[model samples]
Target: MSETATVFNQQLAARSAGGSTDAPPPVRHVCVVGGGTAGWMTALMLATTAYGPRLKVTVLESPQVGIIGVGEGSTPWLRGFFDGLGIEESEWMPACNATYKSGITFEGWSTKPGFQRYFHPFASMLDNMTMHQFVDNVHARLEGADVHAHPDRFFVAAALARQGRGPRARPNFPFDIWYGYHFDATLLGQFLAAKALERGVQHLQRHVTQVQLNEQGDIAHLQLDGGEPLAADFFVDCTGFASLLIGKALQTPFVSYAENLFNDAAIAMPTPLGGPIESQTVSTALRHGWAWKIPLSNRHGNGYVYSSAHCSADEAETELRRHLGLLDADVPARHLKMRVGRMENQWSRNCVAVGLSQGFIEPLEATALLFVQRTAAALVEALEQGDLGPAAQQRFNDSMRTRFENTRDYIVAHYKTNSRTDTDYWRANAENMRLSESLQGVLMTWLSRKPLAAGLKAGRFGGGYPIVSWYALLAGMGIFPDPRELQPPTSHQARHRLDAVDDFVARSATNFPDHRELLAAIPPRVGDKTLQLYLW
Candidate 1:
């Protein structure tokens, strides 16, 4: 078993022996309030045999509340979640109008004129010699070489994405390319709800009118709209921003990231695919905030996330339409107000909050679904480790806080390193914004040298993005140290490596099929059987 699992098991054994004799019994009955991605994902995760031998999972969803449904992009970790559930990509991909995502393409984030683009590919940098290649590029840059000419060319997935292609059926690639999905969020909720119900998770379509607290201040029972009061040993609050159970009832304090992340609202709309669909999420920096374009198999999910302090909703929508070249086209748009923060304690007493109820950063990197997956997995691990006592709850809270803060730092790095000075928003984010102490320190260190993997480790559950991710964002935004800080590579070796990179790019462009063609070639699954589709 992995070290993390071993440690968790050890903690569980210790807790079961003598820790907190007065603590509540091992959580067997779990009531998840609110049914969308968060609720169903939590229910289904707990319903697994790994967690469900003595556990009963139920989901209480309100018929009156509508789903926010704007989250369309996801990180590659989602693929592991599906695999754990024994769910085939063919089973959910078509059902969700899903398309493979190589990674995100960031545009116009630099101060350079015209459009400057960079790729944050999903492929694991650990397996690939990314850092070594970065070192070579740094040496080249010091020698006045045009090393910035397609920095992402070394990444196979990024190269595929640039050519409007997906992963190819090749055996001898340098590294395995990782990919996620772009799908309809509403359909995803329906798909997960179906899976959860199939796995014996009871679903109640009723509004929660009241929350009853125990003597110790933990949630005891919930009063439904027209049914008997529902009670459980533990509760999960998936009620989105309402945070009915964790926020309103538990009164968990919130820590806002607004000081670093200025965007507070988003206007989302779906537009018909005017042409061939792209194989990645495209985030274009706009005048005020930014616009995201996620291309699903059916339609393109587009949104403008902007600072309410800098621009009005109407103005943001206009800018979005203008950027999408849809100013003359009439498409319905939904305006969403977001609270850019996380709860002080995601796990408090007997209740835990997942998804938006726990917190929300702007959807800059599609982290919402990832947090839901991580939180659900963490809760299951805690439950496996005997009773959810103070020790376990504290650990869970600390781990989640680390994850949120780390993610916040990564997202902030995008705006913090941006050189755009055209608008007030850009100026504030680039020059005047206050960064988290940790981020500031990292930035300071990077000024002297490139970020090293050993130096960037967030021990255990500190929950930062991978070291390569930081490299991509920093190098893409031209945030590097003086090239003279490093020793120059031998002239012969540099030329050979540069030639090899060029050869690889040429071969990759020819080997991969067009993104649209690849999608068209996948045979449709029949009935409900799990088809053996080539996993991305």
Candidate 2:
């Protein structure tokens, strides 16, 4: 390189603002309170990516406090999170007792004959060929014409799960597959903590007795129960429902989803595996709420998410026990109270809220970890922009606020459209009229048999889930005229055969190995090696 060119590049890299050559003080330390998946994930991402070697991260975790692990499932986003860190599935999956998840299957939620069960699969390569056809049929069905709109028949993930096949394809496959996973949440958190520590993130075992604030109301420092006061340039709250820093100390307002969503309590228990594990979560409708059966490599994670207002905890637990065929078994159940809402200001002052501290919209779609990853990644971007003013803070809040509300709407739609009327719980959900304008617009468009694309393009219904996802939820719930009162479509496009779609999905499944076979193929390892290998 020439001397002149080298000097020019060096000069361009120099920082200056307002005719001053000096730059602002760098963010040197980030203190994360609470240590489960959220805290460790935030620390890991920041330590490894955000500020390079210039920033140090510390996680203050209470030894006694446990995380809400009812959501043992994850969306496809987890795959990306692991990949971005250059972690391999073979290594991590075997360590966490995790298994592939093609998608979730809704059972008994809708009692309609053919819709008694429907699979809502993750996005797939073959969906491009069939998603439009599914939407076209949904439009036709809503317009008083008989059409096939069940989501299971249109996508490859559904097919994969149904055939007991893994969601990933062989090395030679041209297209990539998107699927989630079911894992032991506790093990997964420990795995992340180990990974974070290996990369220079600090782990402190201390209980926060008090949170100090500056005159500007920003978090100043933390007082530990038996340790020195700790301070950092920035703070992250992963304290779950207690919301220590973001809620109590920062005093951020919260927006509740009580009216839109009613389920608030869950009774979780573990059940032994009976058959070959399938790549799907089965959500069966119960009298009070729903029961989730998540498949793990060794044991099945079972839980009943119900409304305490509709049924007592004892009753809810009994129902869940019965659902899992554990009524006579001596298995213990862990009950959890859900604080269903989002913080009004997730990023207030110098603190950013992650995981349950920020919000929770139930685990119907298994999106708990998705929010954790998204917030951590977004926080990195906002920090990189080098602005922490009110305007910049407000912009981040607005973006997250919309995301939370949109996710809430999707979960709410599941109950509002349920076909069960056997109990007051189901009836109340079906009669729920309190809804966001965004959700109302989407449902209204579907009811009117108009294209959903219009609402999306016009920004009427905000984008939380994809347009195809909305179609799957509605169409999967059997929201249409009675099959006995149906007639064939009048339009040729609507009447076009879907034999090709069926054949394509069927053929695609061939590229994937059976779920049981795939699980067996992972190189043998002593169970949960991270726990044995990674010592704080």
Taking every candidate in turn, the Cα RMSD to the unseen true structure, in Å, is: 5.9, 7.6
Off by over 4 Å in 1: 1-25, 51-53, 113-115, 124-131, 139-150, 168-175, 458-463, 480-496, 508-511, 521-536
How displaced is residue 316 in candidate 1, in Å?
Answer: 0.7
For residues 1-536, write the lDDT of model 2, one tens digit per residue: 21222222233343222221244324778899998888888888776543455677899998778787667999877876775665778878989899999899999999888888988877765677777788888878877787788888888888888888887776556655677899988888889999999989999998888999999888889998875799999999999999999999988998898886888999889988878788999999999999999989999999999999999999999898888778899999999999998999899989999999999998899988888888887776566567778898898899889888888888999998898989999999999999889888888877777878777766778467777678888899988877887787887637657897888888888998888888877533222211111100
Q: Write the per-residue lDDT of candidate 1 for residues 1-536, one digit (tens) a residue.
A: 22232333444455467642343337769999998888898888777634443578989998999989889998877776775565777678889988888889999998643226788877542224444665556545534454542457667677777777865433334334567789899999999999988979999889889999989998999998875799998999999999999999989998998898999999998888867677899999999999999999988999999999999999999999999888999788899999999999999989999999999988999999989988988887777657578888898999999889989988998998898889999999988558767777667656655434545664322137665576677677766434345344556435546567656666755666677776766534223222221211
Clashes of 2: 0
Full-model lDDT, candidate 1? 0.77
Give candidate 2's error at residue 474 in angstroms: 0.7
Query: Estimated TM-score per prediction?
Result: 0.88, 0.91
Candidate 2 clash pair list: none
- Where does model 2 exceed 4 Å of error? 1-25, 491-494, 522-536
Model 2's C-alpha root-mean-square deviation from the true structure amounts to: 7.6
Ten contiguous residues minimizing lDDT sum, candidate 2: 527-536
